[model samples]
Target: MTGHRARRLTAALFATSGYLATIPTANWLTTRYPAAPVAPGVLAPAGVYVVGLTLVMRDVSRELAGRTPVAVAMAGGVALSYWTANETVATASAAAYVLSESLDFAAYEWLRNHGFTIALAISNAVGLIADSILFLSLAFGSLHYLPGQVIGKAWMTGAAVVLLLLRRRAHHSGQLRAPGFSGATPKAVGRPMRRDGGGHDGFGDRAGTPTHPQQNETASEAMP
Candidate 1:
């Protein structure tokens, strides 16, 4: 597929996955895993969920489709989550995503020059903090799960960093596209071609060089 098309498909896929993660899926290993508390009553392992992928990928989506797609994804995710997860959870999740994703997008724009992983890492960190606070406070009425939430989301962000790293690898490997979905192969951004052949640019050597009448006229009067 073309570069942009690949990037779009990737963004859509990741966005959907992040949204779908909202609905708690049954883990065959452990059913309805309650807060097992990772630390000494600090937080429960069950509370540590991998739902933050939405925020992470949302940042990636921003780079691909800019702010519009990211906002739309957040809205679409919330709408879908409403039917899948409980209304309370969905509301809280949607609000958290909207606030956090928007923040992430803005931050990324300024910090992205450092690198993809670095940019997403920083943005995702902010997003996770916001999402954790908002969701826990609004949905559960308790920050008891905040620590666990952060931990859970950290894993998701790490995975996103890996993806960014991969994309950078592809970019360095000569893929001129920004790794999204699109129509045709994208042309690489490159430097302009130079007319190195014998031509009097009117700045330097004129011997054995052909010069245009307009250029020669301009140069002769300017120099003489």
Candidate 2:
């Protein structure tokens, strides 16, 4: 694989790991602090805003791993959360995550052709809404944490925007390839290279008369 492709695969796996990790992390945080301060005036379970983190992570995974790992991550996150979290919380988490991630993937695909930032921003927004509402409502059967949930997750999304800007800077600096969800890299156009003799341009043909054409003719003549 090329350097660019390798970078992407590593990034995708990293995001996937984060996605899976949020399951246990959120579980632990919620158990530790049923009401944590996401904002000065807003209190929510520490786990509430992680939905936002997952939203952005899903976009990165989609960009690199495409639909397959997204699906796998969702399923694996749910199954793993069951083992790592309270049964009730696990069910709520799984249900909300699957629903939100599905929408996130669809939104990403819809907006992808426009641009990476546009797609990621929109998808993260939508996913955060779905996950926050569904997870909170199902887990707690109340909207008391809605404000904190929104604010915390929004902060995370804002962070995603910054991360995206950095990614853009890296790409423009030739540290990475253009980010895309198209699942294909742009083919690089290259000048034909010369072999032992050198190139026809500056390196290949060093003689007054070109020898490649003559050699081909000579080989054909000798063969016949």
Candidate 3:
């Protein structure tokens, strides 16, 4: 492979691994430690923090490798949980990941073209809430952790949003060379990239249909 392509793939692999690792790590934390107070009168599993980070990790993987890799990583994460956690925890985590991440994926896609940071935050919000509720209910048969789970995950989500803001500022100020935190604009799932590096729908002029011969060639070159 070309050096550039190889490097991109390597980065994607690392991001995907990070996303998958959080599953077992959260499970381990949950088993090793007891529930703790995350806010006034609100208790949550020790894994709350790690699970919060898990939402961000999935976004990074999706941005780097596209949707397929993220989907695969999610599947792999569920499988890994079975090995790392008890059957109850494994099943709960799997169910939560599938349902919540699906919601996350949709929200992110709908808002991504508007702005990456906004999309990330909003999507994480949806995923975190859904995951927390489902996992807590399924595993513990209660929602005592709901408040703590939301608060803890929000902390991580806020941190991630801030980091993205800094990355964009640095790039714009010429202190960073990458066009995005991922080193490039994220490719839209199942769409050809434009010369301007923006993802678009597969319909209409902005959908990446070449308006000129030069545009046609540029579109081809833009494809990863």
Best by TM-score: 3
Give the alpha-carbon lDDT of every model: 0.54, 0.66, 0.71
Listed per model in order, the count of residue pairs whose N, CA or C atoms clash below 3 Å is 16, 4, 0
Candidate 1 per-residue C-alpha lDDT over 1-224 given as tens digits, one digit per residue, 9 for 90 to 100: 97746755776666655544443431110124535554465663352445555565566555555567556666665676656556666677667766886777777767665445567788778777886788778777888777877777786668767775665455434422334312242222221111331111111111334544344334323321
Worst 10 residues of 2 by lDDT: 197-206
Residue-wise lDDT of candidate 2 within 48-138, one digit each (tens)? Answer: 6676677777776766677788788878777877777777778888888778777877887787655567778888787776677887888
Q: What order do you get sorting by TM-score, best first? A: 3, 2, 1
TM-score of candidate 3 relative to the true fold: 0.75
User: What residue pairs are clashing in model 3?
Assistant: none
Higher-ranked by lDDT: 2 or 3: 3
Error of 2 at 52 (Å): 1.9
Off by over 4 Å in 2: 175-224
Q: Candidate 3, which ten residues in sequence have the lowest lDDT sum?
A: 197-206
Q: Give the Å error, residue 51, model 2.
A: 2.5
